[model samples]
Target: MSEPVKVAGLTVRPGEKARSVLTIPNFWADGQSLEIPFMVLHGKKLGKTLYVQVAQHGSEIMGLDALRRLINELDPGKMSGTLIYCLPNPLAFREKSRATMFDPKPGGMNRIWPGDPEGSLTERMAHKIWTELVSHADEVVDLHTASRYCPVWVFYEADGVSEKAPSETARRSEEMARLFGAPVLYVETEAYGGRRTLRASCVDNGVPAIVPELGGHAHFDEEAVNIAYRGVKNIMKDLGIINGDAELPKRQVKLKWRADPKVYVSHCDKGGVFIPTVSLGDTVKEGDEVGFIYSPRSFETLEKVKSPQTGYVFTIRENPVVHPGERLVSVPEIIEWLEN
Candidate 1:
């Protein structure tokens, strides 16, 4: 059953749609506080609660556009459950940086989840979100994009270590994944960057979640936005929150392994200007040449990079400037098409 939820000092009743700002006091230590913009669409009928988060990483701007379109597209009057969305970490978003402005580190605010109430800016922000919004979620969809390096794909956290089989979390996450309808789907077992992420936390908290990686990171791609909107809309339909059939694509590929393939990431051995012969969504043989590294001054070939595995070139390092040991490519062995 759906009940009224209190957020940002306002009680949002069922069958109501309200937009409120969750304010943080002394955000900048100059009597200036941060206000996170949020919207709640409480359906008249009872159903599952779906939490949609946008711009958590600041630089992932496609999610912001997707959410905006959702606000205009979905009709709460005919909906069954609640759709709560928020634009968190305004400081990082305003600066157009990946991480929080409080720190100059990588991974951004997403590194910290279920945040510390008495920690840094990101921590405090995360803490409030966890306590106020996230904990009450039944299902979640976090919008993010891969760095210029990783290509667009849908990712879900699954239990890699469980000896018995795929756990309930994995099943729910995978179900959500199939419903999302992306070109390529990556079932990120625990070994992949699943720790300390919001997705991991939600799963640990008994809330199944999925993160859809849009095309790029910096700017808003209308195409990417359209894809995201469809994903979110399909999830809503799947969860019975909205009354509609999920629109499915012609074909979808699942990045899989016969026995959970160990992903081999290729890093630059020598720092130089790198040129890639392959692009995203390309299939390659194990011994095929992928790209080359060149010296900036002479423009001479410094290194020739070849595929280590017969797989799909899912990720390609976009930036030419590379440092030794920096990741340049990620190739995952494509098992087969997900025949549903």
Candidate 2:
């Protein structure tokens, strides 16, 4: 058996059943108290290490539910490998908010990649997580969902296109997504500017990682929960962590990629109440009216939202209220057969 890996000051021995919580000091309201909570599950058999983390952006709760169910169903005595469950920043989660204390003022934890141990609270937490949890794992799955006001479909972010070893990371992400059994996987090629982002950092260090969107935030949907739950189990099965057949749906959904940048941003022309006529997964063509914005009190149509390209809708705002320059929808310009 291979030797165990150490993360965040914790030593995880291979083929040993163990669970422990790693604390990050003063991550909450200033330097008042510690806030981050991580649960490490080391199975009794040696296998690949996988890090399953949730609530990095605060509002994504589907991952939490999935992780809860996973822990309940997983039996360490009948398993192999190590699974690390990390709550990188629990303050935002406790407050039921997206982004952390330093968000907007500085930025969200998800955007603060690699991190600085001597930086702000969020940065320190990020640095610890990277050194301890993320850097050690053979594969990483970061769970997320849309913000409180938006509902999005399941997708994966594999920003491996810009890298020199594109296919290497892309293939690993595709395999992980397939193991998770998600219906769709979206590849994001654009850079969002933070070097500390989990996905970016993983790729930078040659660790295959993908961030799966688990639907919406705050409230839980039974179907979405089931999808995420089974998906994690399937991933475990694929990793040889468990030795049993995973009951996956027969009609598995194939992955589709979005190739155009213009399809991802739809701005509100006039500030008012915005009503979406199309839902996530809907398809539209150029010049098609997607939605409209109007006065909430008067119900008068002030502006209309139209598709600028032929594509599939991936994300939409559920909240009717809108402001000028806000993103109302995100559609992906579909690319076929890239995976095959």
Candidate 3:
């Protein structure tokens, strides 16, 4: 028998659905308060509860589509555990960044997790959402996209977070990432624990979570959305929240991170007009040609940009213009994870 679930001031029994908007203690520039619109989906049988959220940052929007379509595909009448779906930080979505117009810091919401209840406006909002929503969940799935300048692949936390020893939890996290079916699965540990991202917060709190970084910046790509949609369904199936056989992508490659630079963020050496020759997901070798830099005035080629390592493009600035020492590309290599 499934137990009752409580969140956002609402209690949900098995085999039922409840929808509501959670009001947070924050406001927009116009003084309009912020809220997280959500739905509680309880399945007929007992199983794990998966908490899914999106749009913590303003620019990332595909999460909405994935959640909506996932809802359409998922029938609570036939589900097993419960699924909590919420859109956190509406102010960020309204302004298209993580921080609200009232936020003093321009940095987005991903860096802060389980935030301060009485702290900054954004942290206050984070505190309310975490306390009222994610705290009770058994698992978490956060959807996201790259900035307007580039595309990204799906990723999850790897072993050695906060420089601690690898645990079974990290392996469990990797298993969930594999079920996501994204061609590129980056196993990164650098952005864990202290970062305070929602996923990081959940991982630190004894919950296994994954962040699916779908491509398309500032807009929804039907192709990417479909891929994301399939990924979510696969996750739901894997968690036993919903009934279905999980679909797997062909040749899902794993990218392991060793350190900061090893993750492969390529920066511009000299300021100029940069043009990308490679698209997202294209393979590259160290010193492989990726793009070119040109003079802004006459648009004459000034430098030939090349790949810094042997990997695929995890992210690339779409804008042709570039500045010296600015991050122009990110090429993450495929690496094998060591057994525990």
Candidate 4:
């Protein structure tokens, strides 16, 4: 066997057994450290390298739980290639915050991708992770969840492709999405010029990476966990990382856009207690009464919120309290396409 390669102060080896942890220094904090935890499971035989990561943003808890289960259940002895789990930004996790360090102007680590070695705390951490972990992997799965107020759903942002150029990237994305067994796949036609997003950086570097939305923020959902787990197992089987009979999903659903067609943000015209008359995933038509805004003191209905388009509801605000112009609903236009 060949000796492990060291890059950006991280030592990575190809072997039947592997374990390592990298402590990367944050740019903003001189004395503090950001622990990017990881575990490498190499099987007795050589195979492909796959990296799975969770909680790039602090608020997404489902991915973290899913990763925990995967680690506990996965046996390296029967496996093939290396499996690395990268968990960066451990501080936001402890504080139960979605993004950034605690107190005074919180920020998000997800937006700081392909990071600068001498930038802000989040930026520098991103740089170290990309240089040390992401660059070396053959396939990557960056897990995430919705915001604290939104419910669970599956969505991915991938670059568009043309017929002339080899669409290997787009094809890889679709294959991974199918392996994930999610109900939706969203492709971003335009690139968001941010240097810090993990998916964007990966695409720029010719890596086939994907961001999976397993569940909502903060709390753990069992259904979402099961789905994500199965998806991962299927991917491992497809990649030859593990040898076994993986159950492939019977059918696959593809969603072209991330934002739902019927999605309309019901902003509060006046600040008051928001009362939702409809639940998420409910079907409604244009002008249908979805909810009502009430005055906190008088208990009078101030405004009635109605659907703007005909579609299935996907997201509803969890917190009832609202400010002026707060979004209350997200409805996605359901499209059922027959396979050719």
TM-score of each: 0.88, 0.82, 0.87, 0.81
- What lDDT tens digits, residue by residue, belong to model 4 across residues 99-154? 75532224377777777777766676677778887776877788888655443444
Task: Give Cα-based local distance difference scores for all models.
Answer: 0.77, 0.70, 0.75, 0.66
- Cα displacement (angstroms), candidate 1, residue 212, comes to 1.3
State the lDDT at 135 in candidate 1. 68
Q: Can you tell me which runs of candidate 3 are displaced by over 4 Å? A: 24-34, 148-152, 163-166, 192-194, 257-263, 296-300, 336-340
Per-model tally of clashing residue pairs: 1, 5, 3, 3
Show model 4 residue runs off by greater than 4 Å. Answer: 1-15, 25-34, 101-107, 147-151, 161-166, 189-195, 216-218, 245-263, 335-340
- Candidate 3 C-alpha lDDT tens digits along 79-147: 988888888877778787646656645556777677887677778778887888887688788888866
**Least accurate stretch of 10 residues (summed lDDT) in model 1?**
256-265
Q: Cα lDDT of model 3 overall?
A: 0.75
Please list all clashing residue pairs in model 3, or write none if there are none: 43-79, 58-96, 58-97
lDDT string, candidate 1, 1-340, tens digits: 4678676577878778899887789987788988888888988788878999977888777877877888787777778888889887788789877775585236777778878878988888888888888866898898887675555578786665333333787788888887887777887754444356788777776688888888764567666777788889899999898878998777777775223333455666888988889888888888688888899989889888878788888888877799887767667878567754
**Predictions ranked by TM-score, top down?**
1, 3, 2, 4
TM-score of 4: 0.81
| Most lDDT-accurate candidate | 1
Q: TM-score of model 1 relative to the true fold? A: 0.88
lDDT score for residue 30 of model 1: 80
